[model samples]
Target: MNTKIDFSHLGDRVVYVKPVAVADLPQEVQAQAEGLDELFAVHNADGVQLALVADRRMAFLLARQHDMSPMTVH
Candidate 1:
């Protein structure tokens, strides 16, 4: 299985989408989870979080809207 991905065209406009447990987040963020067990976090290459969205699809959509390439993190 060749899973090679070329991200050269994206340059620095790349973001990561990963699932986050509500319980692992701060109280303030957890409160905003709306009773959901999980959420998706969008982060930059430097490991800085850019946004916390309600779902994985939304996280990817956000990145694309901003002209960024979104990669899923396990």
Candidate 2:
């Protein structure tokens, strides 16, 4: 079963930062997560995941590193 959904309507050249669950992450990452549930995900305007980091600040830092301005998706 295909599990991808589209978000092209949100436009382009933008990044969204949102919280993520450790359980939803990979096993290796979960191991490194150290019982952390405060992870964040940085995604493009199209909803393609870019970076997954350990906090709100890191999410924005990741986006800036990629030459993008991060917006908190609350």
Candidate 3:
């Protein structure tokens, strides 16, 4: 039942990925979300949000597309 994760020591070769609920999005984002209830987010080494993606694969792909290395935390 524990779903928490510790990413404080995550390596530089990886981009942190997490899920975000549609309701938590900003008004502009929520309005453009259409019917999606959730989205995945990609973050860089400094914990900066890089992209909001529709799925996990897209997150990984985005990192690669941006020339950054992606490592799976799980």
Candidate 4:
């Protein structure tokens, strides 16, 4: 599931990986999450969400792939 993504626009920054309940997400987002109760969110230093992934490992891998440092929020 490693789709090519362009991350050159986002300068190098520390990103945070946090867990989020699927039920708490918007209806459209939750609808796409089949059989998933939880997901991981990658946020920038400004607290802006950059991506939502299926697991913590994916979240970290995504950030690293984009040249960003990843840290666990909890």
Candidate 5:
């Protein structure tokens, strides 16, 4: 049985980012995040904000971030 459901039609707010470990990320995202980690030192700031790509569209803006890369993970 295919458990995958198409939620694309839902409003943009439907997809939300919950707190999860970097290891728990989907393999593809985990890999990409790993690579990004090597190149960027993710940081947290009170006012700094960045736009992240989501579902072929710029869907979300995040604040108070931290590094998820291997170098920073430790």
Candidate 6:
């Protein structure tokens, strides 16, 4: 599948969504981006792919389906 989303530098962290393509992403990021299709298609809602960074590295990607109330991170 092809997507138009891109990444941008958000101060200290890199944000992916606006100007990056899935094919251009790093291996780890490609995996995260690929999962969005399933998340969006199954839930039929806006999903959030939160990428957490530390020491200039991607620590994790948190996928959350849209809900009435915001989700809590722990």
What are the lDDT scores of the predictions, listed in order? 0.95, 0.83, 0.79, 0.91, 0.33, 0.33
Q: For candidate 3, report its TM-score.
A: 0.71
The true-versus-predicted C-alpha distance at residue 27 of model 6, in Å, is 0.8
Which is the leading candidate under lDDT?
A: 1
Which is better, 4 or 6, measured by TM-score? 4
Query: By TM-score, who's the top model here?
Result: 1
Q: In lDDT terms, how accurate is model 5?
A: 0.33
TM-score of 5: 0.24
TM-score of each: 0.90, 0.72, 0.71, 0.82, 0.24, 0.24
- Angstrom error of the Cα, residue 24, model 5: value is 1.0
Cα RMSD (Å) between model 4 and the true structure? 9.7
When 1 and 4 are scored with lDDT, the better candidate is: 1
User: Candidates ranked by lDDT, best first?
Assistant: 1, 4, 2, 3, 5, 6
Q: What's the CA error at residue 38 for candidate 3, in Å?
A: 0.5
Please estimate how well model 4 matches the true structure, expressed as its whole-model Cα lDDT.
Answer: 0.91
Report lDDT (Cα) of residue 26, candidate 3.
97
**Candidate 1, residue 7: CA error in Å?**
2.1
Q: Compute the lDDT for candidate 3.
A: 0.79
Give the lDDT of residue 64 in candidate 2.
81
Model 6, C-alpha of 64: deviation from truth (Å): 20
Displacement of residue 14 (Cα, Å) in model 5 is: 8.4
Give the per-residue lDDT of model 6 (tens digit) for 17-72.
22234555567866776454212111112434543322112222322222222222
lDDT string for model 1 (1-74, tens) is 98997888888998999999999999999998999999999999999999999999999999999999999999
How far residue 29's Cα lies from its native spot in candidate 1, in Å, is 0.9
Q: For residue 27, what is the lDDT in candidate 5? A: 76
